[model samples]
Target: MASKSVTLAEQSPQPPKRLKGKKGAKTEARTTQIGLFTVEEPEPFKKATPAVHISAKNKALTLVQHKIYNALLANAIEQDRDHAGTNVGLSQFSIALTDLVDKVGLNSNNRDYLKGVINSLIGTVVNWDFLEAERGEVWAATGLLSTAEMDRSTLTYEFSAKIRDFLVHPQMYATIDMRIVRAFKRAAALVLWENSVRYEGIGQSAVIAIEKLRQLFLGQEGAKTIYPEYKEFKRNVLTPAVREANEVSDHTIEVLEVRQGRAVVGVRFTVARKQEAPRLESVDSDLLMSVTQLGIPSSEARKTLGRHSESDVRNALDYVRAREAKKGATPITNVPAYFRKALAEKWMAPEKSSGTKKAAAAPGLSITGITEEEIREKYRASQLGDARAYFDELSAADQAELIVRYNAWQPMQKWRLESGKKQSAAAQQSFLSWLAHETWGEPSTEDLFKFVIKGLASTATA
Candidate 1:
């Protein structure tokens, strides 16, 4: 296709954007009519700036991570104040914050996330003044805390309490995302630790104890709602002090939140303390043995021994040993001391013993065979009610009769009565009145009869 030679004009295609500036550079610059030399320009400058590089989802995740680390650090600071009597230093705070962030933020085996968090924190903190100024309006608009009163201790308390209230309530902080709740928790911890330690001069141990106890409460079996700082005082402060003083490790520091006459929230501390090891003197072991036969809990038996001096234990043991030694030929059983005393009294007085035996054997709920003291125990739990209410509702004669029947002559006489015997109408009314009086006017005769009869009949049938 060799075409006829013709003076034909050729046009060049425009260079692509990537090559535009460089491509024209190879051409020589021609002088224009104005005699000024023109040259090609370099690419536009893109000024570098600091910003988080992440998608929206990752940004949210990063904020949550920061909150958790911040919370742990604040809690640690609060604990230090409680135990050591001073606020944590900045370096200590930084180390703790970094440690927690490393533990929870990075891949379980890496420190990359931790380093990033630390670096970001340094940068954020370094420009905090400027950021606060610029963000002041935005934060105030957020209605989390008032910037105007931020420095006041009362403001801290009010805000912290508000956040806590939010966490506890379903309408306030609940509408926010779970991540926000976590962030608020961390922020609240920081505010609380600062307010209490710096302004109130509360100790660190108290705060730590409280936080640890709070965690334990969250793990309780039936707990519905847990306050983040609920147990801080009990666990961090009270338990440690008490544990130190008691020389025992089994005691607990408890916080109870009561509402409408019922416990709504409770926090308990399972604390360890340095106790003086139990030193068993020769007598202590014997006393323990004697109490054991009586069915005292081992802990209580140990406590009884621990309370007494070594000399007293020896004396008590000597008395027990000698008594046992004298009765060796009879081979006395390992009965309780009180039981032994009763047996001795019966053995010593044959006539009185026979009378006691007759009364106990003839019992229709009578304390005759048992001691007079035993008779009193039968009615104590069954008949007693609110004293004031009972007296208010009972007639003077009835009150007198009740007191006489229960307490007259040390041991009142018990009349044998059958439960199934039907009473006349008048007698039934009287019985109902007596039952109402006994129940502090809470139960009418019909109600009492129905409940008691139904229960008894059901149990007997069962």
Candidate 2:
């Protein structure tokens, strides 16, 4: 399921196909026979997404939120096709909360947590063509969502006008079935899945640099610095992601590591719908979903599911659940991690010492070369989106301190920083630049160009 990305396109944003109604709900399309389990209006993006910024402690989307978002996008696309050319199903549509929860395998018990993820979309800002400074005049940005709220047992939402158009009339896009999205245990696997499917027709993707792959998974914010050594990155993120992508998604992918005299420099992915030897699903999807609800990713879930017998996994889950349900026991702060530890240690085995088990608790707190000329592009857009993203990752207090400094430094532009100034895009952008530079010296164009190519290579599909 390769999705769309914002880069230098051969064309500009397409005009709205439908008449600009005075007002409507958020986005477009999805499909379902019964409104009960039906996806409302889904618009799937292969997860080759825009540069995004969210105002939150954890700036990135959680695994569940990732699942939830793709669900909405999937429905938006199908709904519009069902009611084509008529103003039948406009934006701000609603989906059955039961349907959403059941389809995406979210926990209904954690109501506030679920709602928290859904509501967070409102504050999410998405930017397209921001890196295409070469096409400066065509740069565009918009909120990923305009409004997101729940009414009774149903969730209702709308996409920003710009996003709605992108979802509905995307010049290039791909569908990532919520079913497959559910199977991904890591966000990187989801990202990789999206990248692979886009070139499914061509049977392979363009050779992408290791740095660009990092950006695809981690985004530009500090992504360049995280995995300096390819082996470490491959061990932690790549190996598991590839395994999960192969096992869960229909696509079978092979990694062709590009070696520069024995130092792995980059890799090309060859993808196709797999011709699998029949093997048992082994663990039921429903059971895996329950694991996901507790914070285990689908890839992890799949691995755990495969290593142990279904009964063993079930007994382990029960062990964790009973511990959580213990009358006077301190709550397990991390249900998922603890559960994994349980499976690894075989906590459910009858011969294990009860005393050792009671005394033992889960241990916690266990904690890049760029290709040349890949970054030799002109006009890097100063990577304002990248800067803004890094800025948002700061603590609220830190963000405020920067704003105060900016206000004082540029008094003429101070009004723009004043509270509730709508005409402040310019000011906010400038402040972020100042803050980023003061915080981390300006990034080199070589590095910025590496960031730009995350999406650039995605465009070279058949």
Candidate 3:
């Protein structure tokens, strides 16, 4: 038996999508120009069609896994676009594990499950060009990921060569909005959304066999075992997927049922891009850093940001930090919950034991005979020394992991990531300095003054 192959003439032509915005449209895709290519913003990440149609032998991704993969793809494409003039291709890509969980509605503090997801991708076989008619003679079968590992707080991964090439340059792909992906609770809805969005540029989708659609959303075995009857599959899975696609996706999809004398055989989607494009969401970098520092995921933080003003968010953070740091202050077991309450209710600054908030101490003989700034600089230096010593003591593997993280922090003309990559001595030294400073953290009023107060005590004794 021979599989049907699609000839060039057999496929319908799809012109490039128009980028021109209509009058009164709120937003278009936010993009960054990188040499010849314009990299789209991460929210509406471009997903390769063939990769999305990975063989049903591979189990359908869990909801978290689905989000993780989308986020990783977004980052990969960004790196690809950014590395335009550079010699390095995508040999091994790295992303802050925190960023992964932060954007995908996962708890950044709980990473035990992420390790499992990475392992599964590395183990799953990717039967590329599985549908022979899709690509005609171009096919390769390999693990979905060539190599993947969690190096402390960073995820370092590589796609198998052929897959990597196609992924980075998908001839035809769908741009998926991450905000929408975050809204999906079920993997089925996500998979359906992916399948539907590819047809977004065109007004409607071509007919798809019912069995293929089922297996695409729920692995082969699941399609067979879970929904034994067609009506049950339609009622439980297809209907909800369509409803979710309409609610959260960029399009409103109406499924056209294909039937033979009332027995359904296939379906096609009539999709229309939403009238108003989703605005590019923005969050203040300073406030984002503050929120994530308190064990809140970035996604959750963004929701809070939507509800409050920047000034309010900053004040709430200040109150939380002050209340937590005061002597004999009650320990907050749940930082995120506490911060949310503080922000929503507009918590006022906590006072010291004297009933009034402590005033900033100016340069004076009574206050350690040193200026506040001077004491802060000395304290920072001490922290830097401590961080340098701690870094030096780490095992070679651990230090290397930190370097990988530094390299991932792109927009620098330093490291070259090639096969058998090596870091330049200068680059290594630069990373050491950065790590020390990062460990030291930016000086803040409460934190810096707290150190100054302690330093004053030691100075008085001297």
lDDT of 3 at 313: 87
Instruction: Give candidate 1 regions above 4 Å deviation.
Output: 1-105, 108-115, 125-458
The reply for model 3, stretches above 4 Å from the true place, is 1-42, 129-140, 276-462
Rank the models by TM-score, top first.
Answer: 3, 2, 1
The residue-level lDDT of candidate 1 at 58 comes to 10
| Candidate 3: tens digits of C-alpha lDDT, residues 1-462 | 111112101122222332332321322222332121122222455578876766546455566667777888877876786776677776778897656765565533344567777777677665554434354667667776778878767889888876787787676666566767777766777777777666543335678788877767666555667566777777777777788777865566778899899888998876554542321124465566578668553334554567688888887888888878889876866666567656766776755234655556443423546776776667665665555565554432233334434555645765422212344665545555566555434555656666767866989999
lDDT digits (tens) for residues 377-421 of candidate 2: 222345566556654443322233344445545535433354322
lDDT of 1 by residue, 1-462 (tens): 222111110111211232233223322321122111011111111110111111111111223333433343333333333333244322222233233322233222123333344333333211111112233422211111111121211111112232222222222110111111232222222222222211111111122233223322122221223333434433433334343323311122222233335422432221111131443332345556565445333333455566655445444444444555674355434333323233322232332234444222222332235543443332333444433343334322223233322222222123211112333444333333443343333322333444445656979999
Superior by lDDT: candidate 1 or candidate 3? 3
Evaluate all candidate structures by whole-model CA lDDT and list the values in order.
0.29, 0.54, 0.61
Residue 161 C-alpha lDDT in model 3: 79
| All candidates: TM-score | 0.17, 0.45, 0.50
Q: Report RMSD for candidate 1.
A: 34.5
